[model samples]
Target: MAGSKTATLYRMVMPDHLCPSGLKAKWLLEREGYTVEDHPLRTREETEAFKAKHEVSYTPQAWIGDKRIGGYTELRKHFGRKQLEKGETTYRPVIALFTMTLLMALAAAWVATGEPLTILSAEWFVSFSMCVLAFLKVRDVESFSTMFLNYDLLARRWVPYGYIYPFAEGLAGVLMTAKILPWISVPVALFIGTVGAVSVIKAVYIDKRAIKCACVGGDSNVPLGFVSLTENLFMIGMGLWMGFNAFA
Candidate 1:
């Protein structure tokens, strides 16, 4: 026991607030065959004092053989774990949104027409996806526009376009869902979809910039790529389909 590996961990363990990362660090140390000297700063005052004393920005600190290991992220890095790297993003959010939208479309169609699966389910899926994406943008319009403007040609040219884009998307989506005037929704969807598609292709493929996508909202980790292009293409297809159906 005396000759075993040893580490010291300082983490929060207050009645009101316990540090999850600290517990994780402790577990990681134990898992790695290290005996940890656990220290709990139980109160806000104690935590502040500890931070000041250590001159560190964050807590859940660890020390092994006189070498200080930082917080959770640092711990992962120490173990050679690949954390979220620069320009590294995920499409999980977009995939989740699309999955949920598809389910919703199917559910709604089944409830209305008593057919669980139908051709019209595709329409519902597109419309619902538009609504969901617009809602997410609405959550942080400024952030969304900042990301949008990164690649959107129109938004870059006309600053107000960024502001109007989300509203346009939401309005078109709602109108489509209500089976309202295709006169409005069709054109709106087509124009925006075309512009967005072009912008995405130009930025991602042409310029070869690995940037975050604003499709599912501003705060997304989804990278600008084929998924983004697909979304725009689907919107175009939906708009065209609806428009043709209106006259035919």
Candidate 2:
């Protein structure tokens, strides 16, 4: 018997819990009218074999019509060329963790110096507040799945970005708290804040329409507008704090 109309297969091997870009690609592909066969490769051997066969080493290795598109950016470009687009959303986990770490660092610094009115204290308060907001905005895994399903968005594409953002933030916090990389903390914090601000602004620009936020996991249902605004404000405040300290 001939294969059914949905016989087309698009393969994707995403690292576990780290595949925002890959997810976005998958979402876009399905939206563009394609069947996607997604598998999360957990082991290094699995990743290597897949890469050797496909001539690519990446979380989101896409095979469409005998052509392999490596990585989220490539998939994005491919989807764009086809004139099929989904709303761009920032990865939440990473942003949240990053914000959390920054806040923790500030709090620690304040404790160490015993100065509640110092720049470090201000930074701590700001970071703490943003972290709280980030946590509040987190979307549950189920909601994330739903958002992608509704929009044909991929899980791999945006998930990794979300993971990375927080990983950086957390790492910076550890460094700051441990005094292992004290010299770099302020600069790194400033950079993170700037990048975050820019990212939020870009999201607002890309999707002018009000949409459901996949910020936290699926559990939290917040409007995108408020989340975006809050994110921007937090980042801006962090940036300003960092700049003020640097110049002072």
Q: Best candidate per lDDT, number?
A: 1
Q: After best superposition, candidate 1 residue 28: deviation in angstroms? A: 7.4
lDDT of 1 by residue, 1-248 (tens): 53299989999999998999999998888887889899998999999999999999789999988999888778888988777866568877887999999999999999989996887787899999999989999999999999999999999999889989989999889988888899999999999999999999999899999888899888888989898899889889988988998867
Scored by lDDT, model 2 comes in at 0.53
Q: Which stretches in model 1 have alpha-carbon errors above 4 Å?
A: 1-9, 23-39, 48-57, 62-70, 75-82
Q: Write the per-residue lDDT of candidate 2 for residues 66-97, one digit (tens) a residue.
A: 66666667766766663323544444554665
In candidate 1, residue 4 scores what lDDT?
100
- Assess candidate 1 and give its lDDT: 0.90
Query: Which number leads on TM-score?
Result: 1
RMSD of each: 4.0, 16.5
Cα lDDT, model 1, residue 36: 89
lDDT of 2 at 93: 51
Give the TM-score (vs. native) of candidate 1. Answer: 0.78
Which ten contiguous residues of candidate 2 have the minimum total lDDT? Answer: 1-10
